[model samples]
Target: MRNFKKYWSFVLLFFSAFSVFSQDVQFTQFYANPLYLSPSFTGGIVGYRVAANYRNQWTFVPGTFNTFSVSWDHNSPAFRSGFGVMAMRDQAGDGNLANTRMGVLYSYDIEPFPDWHLRPGLAFFLQQISIDFSKLIFSDQLTSTPMPPTSVTQPGKDAVWDIDVSSSILAYSDNMWLGVTWDHMLKPVATFYDDNSRLPHKITVHGGYRYITKGFLLSRIEESFTVAFNYRVQDIYRQLDLGLYFYSQPISFGVWWRGLPKNSVGRRVDALAFMVGYKWEQVSMGYSYDFTISRLGLASGGSHEISMIYEFRLTPKKRWKAIPCPTF
Candidate 1:
């Protein structure tokens, strides 16, 4: 057990050298947290919404990764606008390296044709990255009993703050939708040290199509199948998630394969995710498990995620065209 702790500590210390090349926290149930997925998805529904998400990655490993997020959004049909606010925090490893962000976003809805809608969105965020040097074990300290403090020089400040911007556009009809997002548009500086290391811009292309096999009494979606894909590129890293969803009334199930199959040079295959969800009246909830297939293998205990959303109307009698995206 002591050797295990020492092993992870050393691994964390090694990765800390490349801290500037950070990646965003990921969730298997992308649409479950609409605002996080894309600002254009803000207020995509007929009413206001509140959502929360939590993810724990590599549970078998000590202090591997934990992330949490919450968001609120409102759709104003009269104004053809969507407004939202979101907050997220991610913590990694025993060193307590963490990132936090709070942001506000807005989207304008335009109806170009009878059943087609286009939306453009913008978001602004305040981001902070911090690390606790006290928790980290240095190489010299690991070799002895009653380990002495690390000889490494702590940074003058423990945290760095920056401002960031993101933009997105989405187009949708009654059964299909496509969207694109560019994040870190301002190329925010993210390093704790004086060296100018800016957060790299990330591009995402995401879309899906829904096939309704059966309808409810009110002509709403009942039994259906959805096919979706999300592709993302940041710096030199690339990932793709292709998934299928099946829904029948209150129950939904999804299966996803994450990673590029063609890339054999590195860890091309990440995980296979399985998800289950339930919707009751105004509330919806989802849970997913990632079966790690990378070199980390099953010993990593994969990952677990849970999400919840509640929707309500600010006014009693307002209607809007719903974006044709999967709810979970």
Candidate 2:
């Protein structure tokens, strides 16, 4: 009975998450996971940049979801373009429902004016998703001791693999920027079931404006503040995120609100997030935590994310100028 109870409990939580989140994995620190947000960010770094990120969600739930990603990109002055590659994985539930992906990215930088520029990017990726059937016990997975003999367990195959493409474009200046991305260009049909269930294409639009104050923090460096907004839609779900950030040389602080106001209940408010970061020469690190505000409340265990990035030059190659963009 104890085993049965535990099994059912996990099944409930797992399906609940599946219904709410569906296929795509989301990041609270969107800026930290640049490549995941859009391919245009590929090679946005000056010379060469490498970055890694990790996220743990719903701390209170046993076997909750976790995601990790790594990427490397470089700017090419000769080609007037940039390229990169990225890998990511996500796992959830006691059944270990897993998704893994590898992708290649490319972007072209166009200067329309002295301080204004446009970057259009493209990405191609291959993905695989699978769930451990043995770890899951459906309503049919019960004892024969009683009238409910239909509860006997059975196993089934639930795996999918596919290739997808995405594209993005950005317009930026010294103090403001805007961009849009469209993912899952083919609308890949992937599901555990025998029939095809098309994964909805995802679209994200974002923009921000920054203001710098002379000598506000350090005599040699300036203090700056930025207001950012992001809106994303995938299938039937949509989210809007707004953030305010302050930066001074090597350090940054930010607060954000993530929500879907149209939804009823606590799920609509989602979370309020806080972040802090530091940069020293070639390396930078950032951390963030979300405070749950919706119905899930503290039971959601909130969310935590951390990231590290390094920028370097392999040799004294001619450096390609990069467009100024948000650092979130």
Evaluated with lDDT, which candidate comes out highest?
Answer: 1
All candidates' lDDT scores? 0.85, 0.78
Alpha carbon deviation, residue 253, candidate 2 (Å): 0.9
TM-score of each: 0.92, 0.86
The digit string of per-residue lDDT tens for model 2 on 1-328 reads: 7567557755664564355336488887787778888888888776899999999988898878899999999987677788999999988878788778899999988989977778999999998877776676455435444534334333365677889899999888777889999999987655565555666888999888878775521223356788988888887788889999887778989999998858523356788999998876778789999999978889989899998989995543643445444454
- What are the candidates' C-alpha RMSDs? 3.9, 4.5
The residue-by-residue lDDT of candidate 1 on 1-328, one tens digit each, is: 5566656655555467355345677789989988888999988877899999999999999878899999999998778899999999989888788889999999999989988999999999999888888787677677779997655556798888899999999999888999999999988766667777788898989999998899842346778899999998877678899999998889999999998647533577899999999987788899999999998998999999999999995553644578888855
TM-score of 2: 0.86
